[model samples]
Target: MTDKPSGKSFDKLTRRQTLAAMLAAGMVGTGMRSASAADFAAFNPGYAKNIVMPAFAQLAAASESLATAASAGCADPKAPDLITLQQAYHIAADAWADAQMFRLGPLADGQRAERFAYWPERRNIIDKQLSALLADDDTISLDAAKLGGSSVAVQGIPALERLLYRDEPLPPTGCAVIQAIAGNLVAIATEAQKAWQQAAAKPAPFAANPTEATTQFYTNLLTLLQIVADQKIGAPLGGDVAAAKPKSAEQWRSGRSLRNIRRNLAAAQNALFGKGGFAALLTPEQSALADNLKKAFADAIAAAEKAGDDLPADVSDESRRHLATELLVKVNHLRDLLRQDVPPVIGITLGFNELDGDGS
Candidate 1:
């Protein structure tokens, strides 16, 4: 469910609008000046090079490996080959989770976000689509490009997870679909990596507009935090443990739900406040806000890791649910710091409404 679409809103100003409004509020700390355009530009290249490009490159490489392994498994369909393919899927899944933070640039174009990793699936659509494809063997041509253009439910990671992890044995059609979807992932990741590479090589418009990039970075961080709190943990947790939906957890089929959140927080930390990051432009008060946010993210990740790998199971346990709730609190606190404190120090303004669309 990485960067999965959501209907939630920040209920304040979007991060970009907040940044602008912060400038007029005169809220910047004493002896601190607003970031100059030069400040924005100075940090942009490093952020692109050190954070954004590497994420896509890793995704591209991991996806290529997944495609190769799936092709071999499809060719052989033996127990050993399937095991190898499963391992490859885990590696690629983790890579995809890490890169979920940078769901901008080519990744957002043409609904590629939905196409790459469609999730929070409605009505068990992946199951329905995969079942139908397997049932009608002759109807499945097994072309990567064509399949990618088909129902998005069957075109990405969630679909592949269903095929690989289902209770029943994999049909020959399932194997074919696995290979095809893996190939599609490879193609998409390669294209995205190349796009980032080109942008990094040149100063794209995003590079020139540091404020916009910073705003996007903040929005992305806040969105990830919000989703972690609301959708991933809260939605499934519901009003209480009795209302919990274990199946609602992200990566439930693969059982990496908590791992996904940990990776997301790590990426958010690096993207916003890491060395040579957007945080470098912050005033002293803003620096304090960033530092507090860094701690909060670290604390949440630590709690998540300590809660162990079975997030769905953990959610059902009373004590574990308490820990999960604490993690949610920490994330919300971090989001508030971004919304209220950091923006003003960085000379970003606040707005009365949240961002529309997926913050990613």
Candidate 2:
């Protein structure tokens, strides 16, 4: 029998469920303009149903698959079957990259997003936590609930990569930890999906202010592109080709940095223009900017695909550095267009910085 995560985490949509429940009790969102219900009429609710919720749901499903694979492969971390386990982790990580941009609402609460995949390795926290957790057998358990409450460092994709991709032999307890982490991830993803679905069902939880909602949506899109440029590529690329730091890139252990970039771009496109997406609401001039944004993203994806899986090396290679540089430029241009052109037409002024909202 396949091991399963406890159902409790999925049921724990504390923040979002509370918001929706409050709405059901006829509590108006604070500052909701009572007369402006029709202002957001043109906005498509499908962005939640078709894009955000589905993305988290997919992450939950992928996390389940990873947990199952880990359970079966835990007994023999070096067994040939671990390949299947590794592939499962890749699928789950890609799902995460796609959904990472929706960092508002449920995603922003409880350190949920960071718990799934903390990046930039600011202090090599994942490795440190993994070491500590593996050595502390008394604390490790196969149960998802207990594991989910553990350190974020040892409970997500980064820790998984250390175990699955490292050349060193797995610890005696490594397999159990892997399974536990996978289960924890499953619960986190499932809860995120449920929270989004609950919020989407009630207009008050999401659309209380159409202008604010639209601005936040576009802000997320811009932020995702900026992250792609700044963190995914620029961090490893450093200031110049000579200073390239391959180890600094995301998923560098698994060599899927470019692959993650491709997934990020596709997710952004879908979120911005998918069914009931923001594209339908764009004006003629705004539509032109949107088209350019699409082209830039497509070009970026093509360049990344050409770069293949070993993105750090691709960025470091003198002849190939140009491609990485080109991708960064394109993404930056897309961000500029979104920053300068689109918001005014949509009646929202863009000022928040993607990293810190204090206008950079």
Tens digits of per-residue lDDT for model 1 on 235-292?
A: 7777788988989998798887888888888887887766656677676655556668
Tell me the lDDT of model 2 at 216.
Answer: 61
Model 1 residue 89 CA deviation in Å: 0.9
lDDT over C-alpha atoms for residue 254 of model 2 = 91
> Clashing residue pairs in candidate 1, if any?
12-353, 13-351, 18-348, 18-349, 19-348, 19-349, 20-349, 21-349, 22-348, 22-349
lDDT agreement with native, every candidate: 0.70, 0.71
Q: Which parts of model 1 have CA positions greater than 4 angstroms off?
A: 1-33, 78-80, 201-208, 284-287, 350-360
Number of the top candidate by TM-score?
A: 1
Candidate 2 clashes: the total is: 0
TM-score of each prediction: 0.85, 0.84
**Number of backbone-clashing residue pairs for each candidate, in the order shown:** 10, 0
